[model samples]
Target: MTEDYAALVRDDRVHTMLYRDPAIFDDEMERIFKQAWIWVGHDSELPGANSFKTAHVGRQPVIVTRDKAGAVHVLLNRCRHRAASVCERKKGKASVFVCPYHGWSYDVDGGLRKVPFADGYREPVDKADHSLIALRTECYNGMIFATFDDAIMPLAEWLGPARKWIDLFMKQGAGFGVKTLGEHRFRFPGNWKIQLENTTDAYHFPIVHKTFLSSLDEDTENLMDVLGQGGWVEDLGNGHSVMVMIPDLIDLEENLDAPIPDRFAALAAELAAEGHDDDQVRRIVRAVGGSGFNLNLFPNVACSMAFFRVLRPVAVNETEIQHIAIGMDGGPEAANRARLRLHEHFQGPMGFGTPDDAEGWERVQRGAAAGDALWVMLNRGVDAPDGRPEPGHEAGDVSAETGMRAAYQMWKRMMTA
Candidate 1:
């Protein structure tokens, strides 16, 4: 078996083994996931002082919580005593975590707080040395990210050129922050990278999501016709990129008084009745509308439209996706309701879009299993208007493979680093 990771990713194509081989997946977990900053959860999930949620980073179970002091912390869920997870629930408000396997208790900051008995062994165990492992955590625009490698670059610098696009995506919330409405989780028999690439994959939308487009109003359907416009895909460094179609929707936060689109005709007067001013009405409308940029944030997250899609790799060929709907924090109640419906219509188990995408991923997995085709082609638009002025920035059409090439460029660098 060859361990040449470089040869797996070419300028125009990638090998199937990158998505199928168990060895390659494990290597990715170690090199890419552990070392890189991975998003865990949003700060909005922690509403109060003791709010906490469980997440995974590179196969390690983690607890993301706000301590009694109101500071956020990301601690390993594994108990030091018996290696059992201290936090069992997915999310809750807990002052401390108690290991079910043993009576060892830990504070929100993962400090060893108590044991069943203080004196049982001849040697006095040092509590300082038995603290739960904690990762370096940072929050940017309410998104929480953690890393096991302390030597990695600062989170702001690490996000690199991605910060601009992230700022643009957040503009849908219009000055106020966005909160997680809820999440829908589903597992597929495919590698996680399949979904990662799918986020910025504009080429598949017109083909795979044709049903979704057909159901939309003709005016709204026009939004999907960005393929012919001057729209372009951008490689935003550090494995991040965006397939942008509607540039006008990027920073509606600045133009709060912009009129609501025709799609929200039913909500305009209702918003007026709710005492919303013109600016606030526009803000609420944008929150309900959606973002045009499908912002893929490297290893784990895709801030797509109005939802946060997270990818978790469970095994070599198995992956789970968490689709979280986001709504403006203080927006009109009616607008938020419409936003939730929009998310459900597009992303949930019953949604029209996800089922089609899941089928696509499964087909790719099955085809790769044959080992007949060594290379998966990503050569679309390669001979067209492709521009790479720098190492981490590139430009091409909305349906171009610029994102995949740029992502793989960072992947190869990180894997071989």
Candidate 2:
């Protein structure tokens, strides 16, 4: 069945075809992922010069590297000669990237450094001409992002309202800032949009994550329930969005099993050595925000509390998700371990949350294969609250499908452009 892209979306609801259609998925890769300032990795991921990580901007393979001067660069992974990926490993520190196929090598800055048998060529391969294709890379609050399209707007202008949410997430550790706690990668036999929608989806939590929530103590359950009740959902413009569920957790009674991590203790000790008092350290660690907040950056990044989730599409019906957790850098080792444990609880492949969500997404994919399922209703709490700033919320309001709607709206705009 042919799908009307415009008709598939209304202010209050959307059709399932938006999620199921292969054509729409291809268009999104071009108009959305290719053009958008997709999150590549955190600044902390590449701690020093020569550190690099491979990531995908849509289906195109890209590499993010830190040069000797500590400058970050994003380059197309293809070799100039025959288009083979220069960096094969997922991540590592290297002064230069060498292609194993034909021994073509480039510096960490993506400058063409060496080519095997250079003298044999009639037209000398100009190092500048054969340099790896570079992408526009920028950082905000230590988060790295790159755009394939040179004409795209600056990162700050594109961030819009989403910057506030990122600021809040960053504020968690305050001056101590945050650091990634590695990641867990998994593949889902479903569309990537299915996972993106879930990032801001609050309605399904109480049901889908019921068992997981039940595992937590009463206090945690109360917080989860509060999140289910209603929370902030905001469209931060340019398809970026934030779904704040609960505020900072400083007020909560510390559960025995969930005590301040020993890493925090080490951090406190370090702070003490640096002349900070006990109170100051306590305040800093406590303020490292983690209650229940989910912040989504446009097409692919979701910063949820202490963790970040990146949704990468492999196919119309296949997706790969990477979950990365972050904590204060060199802060208390205890706190960092605690954050890792917390991430493990929900983000791990077999963790309480992800596996459950995966099941739901797989079901959606199976249902969509029928072809007769025309739409996926997003009419939750349509009349329950008018929390949006505009006349009609553009997906990002309590009980609102603001994020989903914002994504589709951007999709339609870009596709039609």
Candidate 3:
């Protein structure tokens, strides 16, 4: 019998089985993660030729590498023979990957370079045909994504309306290119969708992060009032969404004349003392503070206000989340340091925000054990709407569940296809 995945995901709610059933989880791994453009790494992560990093597309481990010609390849980590993993390091510059089990080696582009004891085989092996499997990889702006399905649309077309928002989010680079400084990775007892929904759920910000708010200065606290701001959540087609928490900070290049906030005042003074002009100082400070919106791209990645949030599903009840800190590629040291400090304050494992959010998501998975008949309600802001979105996009107030609904609809589409 068919699973009827569409029936499980309605316009306003999804069945709790989505967070508890291993069968549904397995289906999602094949349907969505394998079929969709899964974000693998950023341009800065590879840096130059031979740079590589380990990543996952669903449960399949893969290696993201940049070849000598600067071409990026997402190769299956397993060797062509005996299925031994060719690489194990998280990231580094590597010209070749040698399987530990055997001396079989592959080039940075996953071309099988050599095999030990080749004479033992009855027939001569074709190196070209024995190369590691490679996924279709493409990048937009500085973000890289890979997919197993060759027939799916290009990353840009799949991104659709979200591309504009991605361009806006990149403005935080402050004229310099964006670079991934580092990341905070942690595993939580929850479904990946729970973390996905939380990225755009402004309604939980104040309640769940009350202590984080209290730790901020009064002015900073006021600025962090996401729901009270004239903000809105827009569904940016193909499961992507953007939650604008501070409209004033939408364009980091705009409002050059605005006074620097208290938290950034000292940094601004340091920049000025370093001989930076007024305009340059303001621009750097604003970039360090990050953008005002969270761009939640479908499946596994999100540009969450100031950082890149990537989710990896481990099981029906386990998810690994990575909060990647980004900074200007060649920007001033002071500005980059300020960005790191800010990331540490809220996104670090012991930071004021992450622990609390992790606990909340864990509780959600724990609560799922209570019943199988309940649904995960996602009807917020449906009856009463307050703001308009972009011309072709669907939107709701800042605290709405519009983003979650958009994601679930996409989930249903892929699962039922």
Best by lDDT: 3
State the lDDT of candidate 1 residue by residue for 1-417, as single tens digits: 548889888888999898899999999999999999999998889988889999999898999999877788999999999899888898999988899977899998999998887689577768899989989999887889999999999999988888887877787665667888899899899998898889878878889999999989987888776564556677788888887777766766655566666889789879988888877777667667878778888889988878899999899889999999988787667887898888888887779899999999988898898874579888876654342233343334678887887788888999989
Instruction: Find the 10 residues in a row with the least total lDDT in model 1.
Output: 385-394
Candidate 3 C-alpha lDDT tens digits along 333-392 = 999998999899999679999999999999999998888689999988665333344354
Q: Which is the better candidate, 2 or 3, if ranked by TM-score?
A: 3
In model 3, the worst 10-residue window by lDDT is: 384-393
List pairs with backbone clashes in candidate 1.
Answer: none
Model 2 agreement with the true structure over 264-369: per-residue lDDT tens digits = 5565676677776766566565654374578877789987777788989999999999998888787766657667777888886889998999999999999887
Model 1, C-alpha of 288: deviation from truth (Å): 1.7
RMSD of each: 2.9, 4.5, 2.4
Better of 1 and 2 by TM-score: 1
Could you tell which candidate, 1 or 2, scores higher by lDDT? 1
Q: How far is candidate 1 from the true structure (C-alpha RMSD, Å)?
A: 2.9
For candidate 3, give the lDDT of residue 60: 96
lDDT score for residue 239 of model 3: 91
